[model samples]
Target: MKKLVKLIAILALVSLSQISVAGDPVEKKSEMKMDHAMGTMDESKMMEHLKIRQEEMLKMHDLSNKILAETDPNKKQALKDQQLELIKAEHIQMMSMHHPKMMKMDK
Candidate 1:
């Protein structure tokens, strides 16, 4: 019974200390709620970002294709996997431009 009581006391102290050190939870939530203000970004600015990214992705896809053209089957498969990842990143970036994720920062 004494050992159990000591363990409980230690756990309680650890939890309390962590809470004090972590600071405010409300500030964290507000940071997530805050969205990117796209009001300042004009159409041409958006187009420019998109255009540059599209060109880069195209170049990477071409490079990946060239890698897959090799006679080695293993190298071809690896190149294909890398190509998929580049495509996924491109899609994610495209989506983020319209609906950007909020920064996880102190409010």
Candidate 2:
């Protein structure tokens, strides 16, 4: 139990670092929102949910990045609109995963 707890603590720290470093401008904002929302989670229990969400986000971001990187204008616009929902979902997941700190109101 003691060793497991220590391992989770270490992983939580590393995941936080990876999530911070591995993103572009838009993705970076998502990362920041997630980190901010994570707030002060319980290190032990949060590990499972954190790992699952991180994997899911990586897939989502990768798909969005690939679509955005395409050179076609029409398709780009279409993909952008589609991915917009994904971005919102990402923010929601960030909030629900840890804390409600990620959401902000529109002006």
Best by lDDT: 2
Candidate 1 Cα outliers beyond 4 Å, as residue runs: 1-47, 99-107
TM agreement with the true structure for every prediction? 0.41, 0.40
Task: Please give the lDDT score for candidate 1.
Answer: 0.45
In the range 34-68, model 1's lDDT, one tens digit per residue, is 23564454566556544554455455646544664
The window of 10 residues in a row where model 2 has the poorest summed lDDT is 17-26
Residue 102's lDDT within candidate 1 is 38
lDDT of each: 0.45, 0.51
Instruction: Please provide, for model 2 over 12-97, each residue's C-alpha lDDT reduced to its tens digit, 9 standing for 90 to 100.
Output: 43444323223333443343332445565456446744665576556555555666477998888887676555555555544544
**TM-score of candidate 2 versus the correct structure, residues matched by position:** 0.40
Position 47, candidate 1: lDDT: 63
